[model samples]
Structures are given as structure tokens and as C-alpha cells.
Target: MAKGWTFQSLIDEQMAVTAHCQTAPCHHRQVLDLVKLRDRFGPDAPAMEWDFKSKLKCSRCGGNKVGLIYTPDTSPTGYGKAKGG
Candidate 1:
């Protein structure tokens, strides 16, 4: 079973961009961007934290990027969605 997730926690974290960043030199910046994105979207509310956690490659580095991955309107179990669907 799964539970509903909200962006309250993420908002507290103050991330900017929601997605993971792969840029090596900017890894720290990536984190900052995520927080910034969150802040931009919701200065007091984030996009909502995913109920489940998943591992995704950094969009900039192409390697395993560690962090909380947010799935829109879906639970972590839904990560198996068909590719390019």
C-alpha cells in the first residue's frame, strides 16, 4: 500500500530545481538549484515530497545521483512506468 505525499518537507529544505543535477563541478550548485526551484515554486510550500524514494542518474553527470526524487501525482512504486510512454 502507499500513502499520499506532500511538498511540505521539501519546502522546509528550500530546494530550487526539483530534478537531480548531473553537472560535476556544479553538484553543490545542483542541490542549491533544487532548493531554489522549490523556493521559487513555493516560498512557503514545495512541489511536495514523493512518498517513496528512488535512485536516478544526475541529469548533468549521468551517474547515480543520490537524493530525494519527486514523482508527480504518483507514488514511488510507479517508477516502473513504460519508457517513452
Candidate 2:
């Protein structure tokens, strides 16, 4: 919707999101509410300062290299939409 959604913006919006493992040969990912990120690192911690890669650990292989992504609207269950449509 905007020019480009920054990792900071996503965190600020508290949108449901996913983090993918960036480690080679390990394509692990997880979707969770952005609030968790804020909660874990504190609201003042912007995306740049949060160092999300450092904060997250891949449950499958314990990889630290991670990338944040916006969760796509592919849910079959109609709750209208998340945050706002």
C-alpha cells in the first residue's frame, strides 16, 4: 500500500508477520504477531535497533539469521481481515 513496507513500519503497525531463517540450507520460518517482537525487545527498539535476527532463533535448527516478512492474506477463515483491509 505504501512505497515500501519497512521492517520498522511492520513492527510499529503490530501486523501479524513471519520471520524466515536466512541460514544456508535452513529455510525455517514462523508466523506470529508483531506484538511479540515488541514485547520481547521493547517498543522503543526500532527495527534497526531491535536486531531481529539476533532476537529470533529458528526452532527447527536454531539458526539466528532471520528475515522479517509481512504475512500474506491467504487465510481461508474469514475474520474479515487482519488490522485493516
**Which numbered prediction scores highest in TM-score against the true structure?**
2
Q: Tens digits of per-residue lDDT for model 1 on 1-85?
A: 2533334554444323345544566462233344444455543442333322233456666655435544333323657865452
Off by over 4 Å in 1: 1-3, 6-17, 21-55, 69-85
The segments of candidate 2 whose C-alpha lies over 4 angstroms from its true place after superposition are 1-14, 48-50, 71-85
Model 2: worst 10 consecutive residues (lDDT sum): 1-10
Clashing residue pairs in all predictions, respectively, total: 17, 0
RMSD after CA superposition, every candidate? 12.1, 6.1
TM-score of 2: 0.52
Tens digit of per-residue lDDT, candidate 2, span 1-76: 4234444466545455777888889888788555665576666665542454577788888877777766543555
TM-score of each: 0.25, 0.52
Q: After superposition, how far is residue 42 of candidate 2 from its true place, in Å?
A: 2.0
